[model samples]
Target: MGHLRQIFLFLVSIFIISTSYSQIEISGQVFDDQDEKLIGATVMVSKDSVSSILAYGISDANGKFKIAVNNESDVLFLKVSYIGFGTFKKTIQNKAQTLEVKLSPSSESLKEVIVKSEILRQRGDTLSFSIAAFKGKNDRVIADVLKKIPGIHIRPNGQILYKNEPIQKYYIEGLDLLEGRYNLANNNLSVEAVSKVEILENHQLVRVLDSLEFSDRASINIRLKKDITLSATATAGIGAAPLLWQTKVTPMIFTKKQQAIVTYQSNNTGTDVSGEISNFTIKYAGVNFDIDKKDWLSIQKVLVPPFSPERWLDNNVHLGSVNILQRI
Candidate 1:
């Protein structure tokens, strides 16, 4: 009786081991009717035609997929599906095999997709704001619309502040063409030419040391519309108090290999248009001699009135500047 019991136990153990290793593997490549490999297709195995999923796999970039399902019965159901493609189903035998599935285009039409633009988006350390969502009808220049964006402030001196702190740098299409004198671009650039504004937080200027160094400074970048490579802004005004006049013309060109900005502004209305060309110093930064000292001294001598500059001060000023950046 003892010998018979040992044999029974041995046979039971063998049966259990064989059942444990009874998983059937199915490997296949999913393709369209045109023989094009369809990536991201869903391949699933089920015990019945409409039962719960037993195993599943997604086609890789090469449109290859592999699924392993337990051999519960002699047959299993396999299903493959992709967007805009008809579903493929088959009664596959519970055995390891490879297959190539070709899915035909679906006869049913999909609903119309209405695409909407995004107002704001954040990816990694960069934040992008769309101009169309923030720009108002009265906004003419890029600076006017920038004020409507949250967490951004434009000072009277044309300095851009992000979150109450001054930005470290300003860029146009990833190029620091204006250097620190970005007020010219900010005030003169047309709102229609710009598509979006991006802020790069924790910006590191040096690309070589990006991994080794970390920075807390933030930078602003202006992106132009695809069709707008050349833009110009001109303003002319004449008032009849004491023959006050102001005129400005700025033409700018941005291309894949070159960028240029030329400006000519003249005014007798005490607007101080020359300030646009002066360097905007950031925190913990200074200039050699403060090139804007003469302009500041003139304002001090006049004892600037509490009212607007166009009302009181009588003066004549002309400013012409040309800035160009060529990529090698």
Candidate 2:
């Protein structure tokens, strides 16, 4: 029994040695038709186009590749391919050899491509306006450019309107950073940093009620330039009469992961920057009244002027606001 087992093992070893010697190693150099070495070219050996790959190699920086195929097929197919070049294929015998393959550029010609830009386009319920088309050379802030866009309007008090109606929501890159107080962003954001403005008509503020409830109100979204992630605006002035001074500093950041805006404005010139912080979305949400004792209850208090507060009030005012929103 031991002699029989030794004979079987010896036969297995001979079969493995013969299989190792039968493998055919092929080395090749790939080059373009101009005789330039083509690096990262693919060299594959197979029995036929539909057959499984017998061996594969990728040309190195020197355009040299080595592939060993252990197939016993009498005829083998060698294929070499590279980007923008015609594939080279040839049938060869299963033998050890060297190859010098040259590939030619594809003969096909691509059609001419024409890129046309639109000032405004409407898709479904959304309207997109290109800022470059509407923005004037004199436009400093985004609000000035927004005013130039047809069908959109800006009120004297910094309220944005669409077709004589107010927008339900305001978003900077799809984020509600300032929530209802979007005037701070609309009046302060630079025009150069904005790329496009999109309006969502019949916008449903609540996602859950999108299909259930239909709204006629619209929403405005601002898309910033790709390179503009951080922006700031600072203005300071001193006048001669009454030692008048006004200064404002606003810094903002808008990115995919987060959005933040901080502003500090003080003026004795009656610029009324505090109006930017007032929530203008009161119409959408239920309103609550705040009764002041001096104004509401006291009857003998100094009679309030009918004109705007900025015109009657002659005092220094300072306003500070910070808004931030982060994605979890």
TM-score of each predicted structure versus truth: 0.59, 0.58
Q: Identify the runs in model 1 with alpha carbons over 4 angstroms from their true place.
A: 1-117, 238-243, 282-302
Candidate 2 local lDDT, residue 29: 100
Error of 2 at 323 (Å): 0.8
Q: Candidate 2 clashing pairs?
A: none
Write one digit per residue (lDDT tens) for candidate 2, span 46-164.
88865645666778889999998878888899988776677789998888889999999865442211001234445668877778756766888888888766567787767778877
Lowest lDDT block of 10, candidate 1: 111-120
Candidate 1 lDDT for residue 179: 78
Clashes of each: 0, 0
